[model samples]
Target chain A: MNILEVDRVSKQYSGHKALDNVSLSVPEGSVYGLLGPNGAGKTTLIRIINHITAPDSGSVTFDGHALTEADMPHIGYLPEERGLYKKMTVGEQAVFFARLKGLSRSEATVRLREWFDRFGISDWWGRKVEELSKGMAQKVQFIVTVLHRPKLLIFDEPFSGFDPINANLLRDEILRLRDEGSTIIFSTHNMSSVEEICDHITLINRSRNILSGRVDELRSRWADGHYSITFSDADPVTLMEALAPMAGSFSTSADTRGRHTLDLRLLPGATLRDVIARANEASTIHAVNEAVASMNDIFISAVKANGGDTPAPVIS
Target chain B: MSKVSIIIGREYAERVKKKSFIFTTILMPLFMLALMAVPALIVAMGGTETRTVTVVDPDGVVAPQLVDTDNVKFVIATAGTDTVAASADDDATLLFIPQGIVEGDKPLRLVTGKAASMMLENEISSQIERIVEGERMKLYDIDVKSIMAAVESNLSVNTVRTDRDTVGSSTMSYALGFILTFLLYMMLLLYGQMVMTSIIEEKNNRVLEVIVSSVKPTRLMLGKIAGIGLVAVTQIVIWGVLIVGLSAAVMPALLPADVAADITAMNSGAGTLAQSNLDTDLLSALALIADPMYILGIFGILLLFLIGGFLLYAAIYAAIGSAVDNIQDASQLQTVAVLPIILGIVFGMMAATDPVSNISVWTSIIPFTSPMVMMSRIPYGIPTWQIVTSLVVLYATFAACVWVAAKIYRVGIFMYGKKPTFKELIRWARYK
Candidate 1:
């Protein structure tokens, strides 16, 4: 069910390997987060997939066909470095871009009007792009990106210039696009949103794909098999005291909320069932859940493990 | 519409609505009309300055012939000062005629507050010459008509082509050629800079990235180029219609009949081309224009070369635009394109006087200069092979230049902030 697949793609530019042996498969009807630190070659892979630049080696298949110029109409890409013709009116520029993406004149106008009204920017139809504020202009560009309603939508740093309210609005729209069966690929440093919306992700670092999988799988893969237990039995210390015997082999902490958490290092024979069974002997187990890492933690840890030279971008 | 066509339409439609385009389209023709009409108006209105000359005829022989003219009035002074004063009582000239003037020992003297203009001096001298000649004739009793009829002979050279066609006036040919050549040159500068600046502006504005991702780079550049070319052509046609309309109808109406006749005489031949004989020069120029082949050939070559030359230069201009981050970075390479067009203009102007010179012959055939130089030569009747060769060279150069430029432009649009050098552009062109 992959809508787009880029495999073993390598691209070189003036002695720099912009993308090297990168592979990614975006599932249909899912939001795919393309994650990377600065200069991680995410944009390069996006460009290759979009056919903006050709890969030195490897191939990209879109909707079961090799990506080609003919496929451009089916792929909508909103580049990170994007702008509109400033002298052109907002609606005029939007319609022109939609037309470039293979929309008919009447079709482009109709579709663009829908998007403009949805974004509450119908009044900006006759206003030039220069007259719009930065966020307003970005809204115009975002509408343009999705106006053609291609099967595969790619957005690079789409939320960079939007306020939280508009960002959430765009986030809702992006999820809606996914729900409607359009595959989405967007690259950003915002991990919380990535976790919030993305079902799958491909993490690229240092011109290579470091890790990629379903978001839940990736977050759990980076997780330590530790559990935080909250029990309201006769005492929560009973749970801590139960782990006190294996204190030399495990770590334990008790929060003020009578929740006991234990960091367990697995022995060859030890299992989560054993730990739970041991805890049950001392107290009634109210809740037992394994701790999982957030996407931000996984991103930083994965980048750190792979080459680890690049500074981890601060999550805002 | 196809993507390229859509892009072309957008490029054309968006700019055509701009205030700058409308202002230029309307203003340039007016400027051209003013250029052609202002001088003619001044000459027509300059007829009202009249001056009076007082003649002090100490000698009786000079009094009877003193006459008035349109701009000069002569008042015969029966009694006058013995000496001509350094300054006149008014701005008019005062002449003191002494007895020595009838003899060969004295010169006719004129006195005025302001120094005499050569024009006034010539008029006064001619008046004196007429009087002196009359006096001399009366003294010798010789009739002036017999002298002119006896010795003056009219002779003219009529050049007929081997095909039994009469050659037109060389001056008129030069004027027409120079004007057409200048028009080509100006069109190149105007349209060439427009294409270049438009590209740079798009690049700087970063709008190129979105458009290029959707449209092919070559189509985008060509679309923009063609769009601006259409605008340029629209402007030129409008100006052409306006200027031609003004020259053919309005100018004649505004001018006095005699002055208009003078202009027509001057435009044609036989009125005052330093060889006036039955207006043959003017007639031939008019005839050359009237000849279908002449009209077809001049415009044919002009159209061919205009497209060829502009395409060739626009490729270079677009490349220069792409090679930089903005107009400031483009300044250095801009001179490279402009200097050649200028050299072509110089060769075009030089070709009018010395069409057969090595410079004209070479520049007329070179692609960069061919549009202007060949335009000048075509009006003067160039050889068929030369025009064909220049056209071929121009078209070939245009194809090659666009090919190279498209390569650079594709790479340039993706680039940011770097001020690329010529060598870098060459390398970019070399890249896949």
Candidate 2:
């Protein structure tokens, strides 16, 4: 079941359309990836969902009801631009955010202490935000974001400022939060991380959702009809001679250790069997594999194909 | 707590916990005390200054009855410009009553070695006039009755107001009005700017987005301005109570015993000052100042106007803070908020001098300057309709400012980089 739904939302600024008829459905207890390039209206859509800015036309439903101010407590939003009061102590800010999310003071303190202890940042409670490094401040914001135990957590570039170790820790916590029944909507430029964790994907380009589906489905949908063949005793000339009749294109290269590999794209009527049989006529085949598109490749191609004016800001 | 209250708490706590706030709260009262005490101390020491004057009577007219007091002594010198010049070396002021003195020419030449003192000069002149009067009374022999008849019977008024509460010094009223107007004026400027700085700080740090996401923008603005206002109010009230209390305690110790007794007698309403032989201006000023009712009345006015004036202006200050990306960039916009407050102060100063004049009446009834102008006029007992009209106008203006400011603030706080023009801010009010 989808926990949050944005329906036909459109928003316009003074001279620009920030979002145009955009829609998305975030399922319960699953990680959903919101993909977009720079100025493709991702931030604007996220802001609308958070109710920081209302959509000029459209409705947002949470769980089964129209979203309202009272529903804010059930939704945790960590904006792409992270900030905290510089002069405020970490603990006080934590409790204050919790209270703003409708937690009682005692409940906030207890939960905050547990989160701080779990993150090994209990020492930061007394430190002012300006005294902390950017990574440490991001951690505080992360803790504040999830401390309310929200049902729907929208994190925009949550891993921007973390070291690998801390990144892994946060990744683990995000997965754990999902496992414990919170639906997550994650937006990032790190395509690898999205591949690792995101189950569902929606790609937006030029203020429109161009492609969306399961992560695996998107990868397969964008895959080129090519196969990578690893073989023994296969010379480039022999393979070219034997496969040129059925193959549309081919490339061959030898590694420094003298292992030869051949790449081939089949003609429209050709099958894997035809390529494999032709390859066998030339040399002993050790292995044959089809090349599936990576998320990064799919993202670039989809954006290019849709004619995006500028590239998305890629973090990794 | 409501979300607005949480924001209010955060805003208030951040400021009150600052070292500057702590130091200002403690140091400002001490500064006021120093200002009040230093002058009173000087007046208490006034009796000890001494001077000597040499009288040179060329006509043999003024020597016999020129008696001297302990602080101001006199010595008779033989008549001449040369003798006066010789005595001048000792720094004794030389007072020359020439033979042609009755003609009012060569006009009572007094010479001294240093810069002249008006008090010492006036003392010598009055003594010479007395001595000359005695000599003339004997020469004329029938002149005492005629001299008495020649004196003009000037009439002076001792006014008692219809309220039967006679704290009777116009200077004291003007002084109290000036003090109260200045205090409210300062609180509004200081606290309104504080709200502006606080807004700009949050904007600069990029924390305003996080805050606005949690609470509505209007609520956030309200909490911020009202919270900082409460802190200013608390500080001013504490200062007022401290000054009043400290003055009550320390003033007696600072003043001489009989002066203290006279002040207490006036405070206690024991005797009408007009009936006393001591007809000094200082005693009347003291009587007016020491009236607890008058002081209390001023205290009440300050409290009323400080909050009202501060909120009236702080709303616009917050809006100005939000309309720009940086504090320095916010300055041009700040002038819009600052002008009315400065006008109010200057108007109050002008209007206190003539509360019943048309300009005072007009300015005091207008909401922008009324917080200050009305307070200045209040001590002079403003008419009820003027006070009511001013309050209604000001309250309405303040409400309207909050409404307009909130509209600008809601959208402006999230805007980055560009410095918005006044027209753009107005447009933002209508934007989604």
Candidate 3:
């Protein structure tokens, strides 16, 4: 079941449309990626879901009912532009936000301490936020965001300030939260991370949702008719010669271990089994796989197809 | 706890723990006292060094009558002694009296190594004039003591209100009114700005979005106002306790033994000491101050006006704080909150002198100025109905203002990049 459903939502600012007829569903217990370029109405959609700002012409449903103020406690949000009060103690600020999310003071303290311990930041509880490094502050913000055990959590650009190890740690925590029956809305410009963790995604561009679907399904649907095969102890010339008669284009490269990799783009109506049979006659086949596009390629191509500008893909 | 209370608790605790808050709470009263007392203390402590006036009285008539004062001494010099030709290092002033008949002809010249202060010059000239006048009076046979006695008069005016049988001191009323009114003015401006600064701080911290997601922006705004308002009230309450406690402990030691005894006796037997030989004005002023009922009355009124006035202005300040991106941008919108507070003080001063004036009555009734204007009038014995009406209007207006301000705040906090104008603020209030 969809935990959050935004139907035909639209938001207008003073002189511009922030979100235009944007709609997406966040299924329960799933890691949903809200992807978009800068100023692509992603924040506006998240805000509508959180009820930070009302939609000009749509309704948001949480669980099975229309979202209301009472439902706020059930949702947690870590906005892209987020911070803790610098003068406030770390432990105190976490408890304050937890209480704001409807946790009792003692409950907040107990839960916040557990979360702090889990994050290996128990020693920083007494320190002021200003005294913390950017990575430490990001950890505190993340801990507070999920400390209340909210059913639905929204995180915008959660990994921007973290190093690789910490970002991986955060990504693991988000997946863990999802596995524990929480619906998560992860909004970010980092497509690689989205490909790594997101179960489903909605891509927004130019104030409208341009593409959205299950991550694997979208990748499969956007796949070109390309395949790659690895041959063990095979000569590069033989690998290329093996595919030369297959009525298709072929490229060969050899690894340091002397195993040759041949990339093949089959012409229409060419069967994969036939290609494998042909290659088997000349060389031992180790593996065979279809070439699926990455989310990065899908994102750029989709945005460009919708008349949006993206930097030219660099070839290496 | 409720969201607003949680927010209030944080806001209050965060500021109350600040060193600046504690320092201001303790030092504000001392600072005010210093402002009033420093000049008087400087004047009371006059020049400490004594200077000698070298008297060249050729005829020896003026020298006999010249007397030494605490800070000035007369040193007689013989004729033909040019004191003016003394070394430049000499600090003494030369008082050269020409040898002439009783009829005035030549003036008395005073020469100093350096330029003499106007105070010292006037002192010397006045002293000589008095001496010469006494000499001239001898020729007329006028008794100096009787003439001096007839010229000095001790007059004290007591104010009696025809509306009531009470005879109150106008001076006490004015002093109390102005002091309390000025205090309200300061608190209104100081705490109002505090509310704005904290809001801007939260916005800059980028924490508003995180907190507002869980709580309604209206609740958050009210929570902030209530929290900061509680801080203001806490400071004032601390000050009140300190003032009352310190005066109770220290006033007796500072007062003269007899006056303190008279006060104690007056407390024990009111009419008995009233018939005794203590100054009625001092006794009444002290009695009014020591009256628990009166202090409670003023304190209660001051707190009511303070809360109402603070809520009214703080709502406007909060809206302004949210509308702007930074403090520099806030200055322009701050005039909306500042001008009304300034007008409150202006009307308060007018009320201090004439409590029943039309402008005073209206300003006291208006919510924007009522906190200060009504406080200034309360000490002057304003009607009970006027106080009730003013308080009702002040609180009602506060409710309306917070409602409107909450609307603006809800939109303004989410707005970034552009600083909003007043028209935009009003338009934001119209948003659903």
Model 3 lDDT, residue B34, Cα: 49
Q: What is the lDDT of residue B91 in candidate 1?
A: 70
Best lDDT goes to which candidate? 3
Best candidate according to DockQ: 3
Better of 1 and 3 by TM-score: 1
- On residues B1-432, what C-alpha lDDT tens digit does candidate 3 reach at each position? 688898899889988999999998998766654453333233344465678888888777778777787678888875455544464246557888887623474687887877787777777777777767766676799766478889977554556667655554677688789999999999999999999988888888899978888888889999999999999899988877766655555555555566666666655544444354555556555555555556677888899889999999999999999888799999999999999999999999999999989999999998999999998998878788999999899899999999999999999987888888899999999876
CAPRI classification of candidate 3: medium
lDDT tens digits, residue span A71-137, model 3: 9889989998988899889988888888888888899999888888888889999999999998999
Name the regions of candidate 1 deviating beyond 4 angstroms: A227-289, B33-46, B59-70, B79-122, B125-164, B251-300
Worst 10 residues of 3 chain A by lDDT: A307-316
lDDT, each prediction:
0.77, 0.81, 0.83
What is the lDDT for B229 in model 1? 75
Candidate 3 regions off by >4 Å? A224-289, A311-316, B30-128, B134-148, B151-154, B257-292
Clashing pairs in 2: none
Q: Sorted on DockQ, highest at the top, how do the candidates line up?
A: 3, 1, 2
* Candidate 1: C-alpha lDDT: 0.77
Q: TM-score of every model?
A: 0.84, 0.86, 0.82
Docking quality level of the chain pair in candidate 2: medium
Task: Please provide, for model 2 over B98-163, each residue's C-alpha lDDT reduced to its tens digit, 9 standing for 90 to 100.
Answer: 885533434588888786777777777787776666566667675654576698574334555776
